[model samples]
Target: MTSRNPWSRPVGRRSVLVGTALGATALLAGSQLRFAGRSRAEGADPWAGWQPPVQSFPNTFIEQNVPIPMDDGVTIRADVWYPADESGAKVPGRYPVVVTTHCYGKALLGAMADYSRYGYVVVVADSRGTGASEGSFGLLDDREGADAYAIVEWAGTQPFSTGKVGVDGFSYLGATAAKTAATRPPHLAAANFGGAPTDPYRTFITQGGNWSSSSALWFALELLGVAPLPFTLNSYGGLDVQPRNPTTDIATFLTRLQTDGSSIPYRFAELQRLIDGSNNFDNGFWQERTTDVGNIDVPTLVYSGWADLFLRDTPRDFRALPLERGSKLMAIGPWTHYSLPKHIGSRNDQPIDDLLISWFDRWLKGIDNGVDRLDPVLLWENGSERWAGHDDWPVAGTSYDRLHLTGTRSGTSNSLNDGTLTALPAATAGSDTEVIDPLAGVCSRQTVQYLGGLPVYLPIAFFMPEFPISEFPGIDQIAPCFRTDDRANEQGALTWTTAPTGTDLLFTGPVALTLHGSTTAADPVWVARLSDVAPDGTARPIGEGALVASRRALDPARTKYSPDGDVVEPFHIHTHEAVLPVPRDAVETYNVEIWPTSWRVTAGHRLRLTIDGAEFPHLLPNASTPDRLGTLTVHYGPDRQSFLNLPVHQGAFP
Candidate 1:
């Protein structure tokens, strides 16, 4: 959560209060006294006061509501900020312009002011229907994309703007940058997206077809805070103070009355109801908002935390863009939702602002900052060393080795065995059954600290290794145990391991499982997580994916897989929603697609896979009935055709 009061220190009044209060009162005391003080303080401008130093470069700053003309002649209002000096200077035809869209929050002028100081024209506009912009905002949908595209074009034509334009921001803003870039706007040149969600349904609204209560609540509250209405005195006093007309500014009034201590939950609940009522993915609403990556044509930089709520969507969108149109760069850091400046292990390295400066220098200024020479994939390695840059993600020269499950009981020695190579039937039938009680669902060992004593929940066992340590310490703490659990009866978790490799294996792209299994429920959702198990028994989660049983038909067009032609389709995994019913006492095996990840598993580190009926918090707890018996069988060997397909690429630079 963002802290509103940045200067409230202990033991005294805030800096702003003490400084401003004393300065004002002292000025009234006597001009002679003030002059004396000023005379003693050499080279200090009395009028400057406590304001921050001016930026080094020539800068122009202004906050104005721009009337952006749309295709239908409907003018959309945008909040624009740019270097003031560029206004009348007839210097060049091209200047780099940065366009940013607000997330759930309305356009914040202060947020974009910093960008203008960096010598670029910055535009922050509310997605149509949001803030002061005309039209209705429909979450992540087409209207927003169109408005973004229009804004990009508008920025390009501005007299002060250089034809070159770039987009940058975090979360909702990040997603907007990507969607707009995909539109292939004429002036669009580059994009940098951080923690952007691509597939909203699968990654944001619902994880594995189940609602995320915490995330949903947070989003709702933010929306309410920014709703375009005003609160009245009667409204604050619990009176029936309805606005005279439908267009009353109730949102503004409500915001004004928000005190230091307010019932945030109450406001959040109101937004939650709006979200809960909408669950259909195929609804025309979501379809209209979704972006078509096929149109994206530019250089792109994507950054996401391994433990980010939108982890899956960030990389998914990056990979979706056609390679021919844009060059893709990905950086997976160890961070949680809000911790930006802090790195893993509590280290405060360079701030995010530094990264942005370097990126802008390369894209906007056309400066050879070595950004073009940098590796396409840059990730932090835990044990071996510090952050490493690779020519391409998931370095080449990796092997696909399988470790079969040979155990029996849920956690007993009988159920535990070394997953070594062995001959098995092509289509064997066996089953293990477990019940998922929603009330007693698995809790994530990690929690995201939020304001007002609220905490974000994560899944317990299903961890992703690629997630950064700082953003998600809880998952990082429990990740190691997920692989080497010799303990007995550890819920319904199933483990499969591979022998340590002798050399580094760079496996990139989506991970898939072609299992043949069936359950009794008509609609069953299965979750799969892949991990890297170190020799010391630490399990690092790398990738995770889920499939709703009924929608088992993989979309052959978007799938990627291992050597044995094991289908690893992306689009078909959760693109469509359908319910598949399981017959009584039936045995079925359905292929499951896990989210894509890129990591180099060094020699002596084991590769692991875990299959569970439920991945709590991250996904909704499965509600499997006792009478419904669900069993999963695996078939391996050259004849049975079991292998993982990885998208391997050689280094772009030597």
Candidate 2:
């Protein structure tokens, strides 16, 4: 049931934060003024990269398998880490608490060793229905948010708590933290999120309004980890059944699994089924799961990468946070979802430990760390490979530049057509068409991102290379590689390229594309990409998007627009009733949302827009049989012109 978008789970299922002090120690010892490459206007140094010496505890101790009762009477599992004296004995002083909940199980988290190793008490809890927690797995259900609220309040009442609590994590765990923050728990003083997006229906579950089973395989993996069958017991160490009742007991664990694993939602199994069929539409169920950032009252920090899967909304959510100015912070790097803040694209030197430590110290401990005076946003200009401070996302002085598709050539890219992309509308009428290759995009960076950079780190290419299809020539090049050129994957793609520019084009926000075209097939699947083609013809990916022709009904209220009333980010209704059928061979206009992104294309680089009728691994185009595999045509002319809107920061160039 999963989309063939490479091989792996969604979000940062692998990157987890544990209670560790060693990491915190590194932060404390790290040089604060190290990011000399950070972009700043003359005399503009708002970022308090200056890390003050954080007072630390001699040691830390964990209370394993702590039973935490939720509001619904079901008890969840947690591991409470407390600051200890030099002798490794627990201390008596009360400290601010950091609470985090995860469906990936508490025991699997790595030693995030930065917070607890300091003076704060950290409580890591397991989401209900996963790990040792009682209740069926809610996969972004409201029940999980309620459970977080209960856990936060409980942590605030502990003997070592200062009555101030902060929620934190990366990916799914971060989403839980955001959900907890939205509940506005009495003890939640601040929150931090990394690659954890609040809007799921349009961005995660059904990307670009094209239904996605992206989580099906991941959910099944979770199901297999904690299933009742003795042979299906977790071998990944992501779950611990004995921890629910005892500290250790293999036989008892198997016995408990056999008796208690028959849940109403069947934990992972039932959740996946619901997502695949009944819960596919955006309705009351998804609305409850989507976190409204406006409801989050505490100070928050948003962290994400340009290539991150959830980049679509993390910045938008930050811009929506109720807190004003520097009360909330955001950092958008040039890395992927697979990378952590500490280990990023290396454009920005500050690690998550450093950022979070200072953040926690400022709000949780009342330190005058100058965090509230720092620029609200910190971005790493991708092409420049440098950090740039900003007032906010969409980068303030950004302008929407429209690039129209034309029949002429730019002679820049080695694309299938090498067609031209200019600012002015085309004078002549022309249309470009290509046969629908449903299995395209197997060798691009999107494949690496979907698989969480697996091929880059492991030998996935050696074992699971791209399958060769007789119908699609050169399909055998699907072998995964790290950050390779896109020209190979651009085969059969209809491209629109611009002449090399005289000045840098700094794009800092969501891109919108208006398409006036039709497909011979009734249900057309469209995939588009924006790339920066270097002088040597290396097409590096900037961002990518996809959509099924039938799901194009827009929701005006949720759709974002510019001052001139142009759609910058279009939100579709995606509900059961909003679905409209496309007539075969009939022309139709559609808004193709190019997912939000931030990057700088050098002066000599040419911008290219590549379109394909099919995408593999990231999206399964044939989600429905008889959906038509006919030719996809893009029309261009004065009346039937299609254009791509880019957010350009005019002030970025010298």
Candidate 3:
């Protein structure tokens, strides 16, 4: 059900008075194409020393302070980027429009003049209440969706528009692109959504039934936007003014936010309301803020980072959007949420921006530049340091390989590196009991950290006052062993590692874990990770998944099964109704779906699986109860076997 104000007309003075009083009530919230070039193999450099063909237009002209009016009479702020000819005159023709909505303010996201150079009229707008736009923010509210629809349509009808429009952005902005596409606006031709999530409640707020504490840091960054600083918007390869809106910058945004009596604490308290599971069920609140990607019918380009926060949903989004046979395209890279700006494809020198521009050119400008003839999927295979092209996302011939969890035969009782993952069942039945400390944080060697157990590079890594290095994604984690090299000796984690492999083992699909376990407490959260253990003993995380024991039921209706109809979806039961407290003393079977991935465990390399009770910062500490600690027992054997289902790509490899 979509949210719309009953009264379509502008809110009268009386309504403003009513709005002020009701302010305390709520807090909210792939396509195919063909390419003509020969399919690039998994390990080839397609873009090395190659540059995208462009019109070579001169400087880009910016039309600042544009106000786009929505149905409810709220005006959203936007900056339109137009192209200039060699003679310094503005290009004189209706051009395809590209719009991006930003939560960090229009100025921060800025207009990518590069697109303008290619004859695209790019518009970047700030979500209402955060920048120059006027209105209360509902955290990606339906109003935002409504505003997006209006803006795209308006851009289409503009004198400078060719009635063709496209949308692009990452994270919050990526989500806005999806929302705009969902409205199925007539002029919406295509979309490029990078690092966006499908379900806001599940992936962003209460992730896997746990609160994302990192959200607080995100909120602080939003607050910091109050003071617009001159910063380089490296992602777009341009210098961007922090606050594009002259009137109400971050300070004004916060001031007006508090003037409504919704103080910072109230805002956080509302977040806590969700964290406390008060609004755990999917209802109008989540719906008002959620975008139905199935509603999006435009050709779409999807971008996902294996090390980013929304890894699981990338493929899910691709499967949802129904586009032309060859219109849906996707590229999965080895990147963190912060490292997406660098055009580097993992270690490859190819600029990701080239692929992006070619995509827009094909869809928005109707230029057949060979991008449509290429394979629909481009996946970065970690460890192999190569990119593979596939006709379908979990390309054909992908088979699930099972690895049974044998007992920890080593001296380290609770170490994750002690156990074994083998193709055969354990010779004998057994069980392992380990204590799960709710307070165990990321620094606690025993846990599987979110986004690959990597050290957080924000605030701390943003600037080294002494050395002052340029901060960017992938820069911090890859800077001289910033993250741990091995977790083999971690104390509290239970791990299972396979013996060295004689042949290269490559996988390109989703991963799942079946665990027969019991916890002493009614509520228990399980963290599972699949990593690669090099012969030298360096353990690098590949993918991870988590589930609050209570939220264990599979919502078959919403879950997608595999093409072979044997495996389960990568995610299940996101609503509160699916949550069920674990039976205190009885062992229960829990199915944990590790996020999808594409990796190659080379010869002599071992695959590892680690399970633990908690990972801080990534998720809020499990519901703590004073000094009480809980014990989790893993039951294995014929009757209660635990194993991992890894998707082995039977397709061609590098």
Off by over 4 Å in 2: 1-49, 52-55, 110-113, 212-214, 220-278, 340-347, 457-482, 625-628, 651-654
lDDT of 2 by residue, 279-357 (tens): 6678887888899988999999888877666777787788789798768998877666655324322324445566776
How many clashes show up per model?
A: 46, 7, 24
**Which stretches of model 3 miss by more than 4 angstroms?**
1-51, 85-89, 111-113, 224-245, 248-266, 344-347, 408-417, 439-441, 444-473, 479-483, 560-567, 622-628, 650-654
- Candidate 3 per-residue C-alpha lDDT over 1-654 given as tens digits, one digit per residue, 9 for 90 to 100: 011121122233234444333322321211111112344455665334323547557666676668888888777877788888776568788899999886676666653226887889888887766666766666778888888889999999999999999988777778888888999889999888887865777766655677765454455555533334333242344333332335544555566565663324435665667555576656678778877888888888888777667666788788677776568888887676656343544356555666677778888988877677666777877877767777675564454555888884633234833787787767778877668766554653223223432344544445643333333445545533224554732467788878777888877777778788888866777888666777667777676777777777875545534322223444566665656666776888888877788888888778877787776656674333321248777778877778877667532111
TM-score of each: 0.68, 0.84, 0.84
Cα lDDT tens digits for candidate 1, 1-654: 001111112222233445345444543562111111101121222112111222434544444456787786645655555554545332233357888876443333223125565667777776655554554445667767787889999998898788888888776777788788888899988888877766665566555555454355456545642455332112111222222221422332243345321224434553554344344343454555566665777878778765566777666665555663215666666554544342421132444554565566676777665555555555554333345555443332322222333332212112223233111222432334444333222433212311111242233214543344334433333332222342222245555555566776555444556664545555556666666667776565566666666556555445443322334444454443444455644655566656555566777766666555654454433233232224434444333444343332211100
In model 3, the worst 10-residue window by lDDT is 1-10
Clashing pairs in 2: 4-617, 5-617, 5-618, 6-617, 20-113, 21-113, 24-114
lDDT of each structure? 0.50, 0.68, 0.66
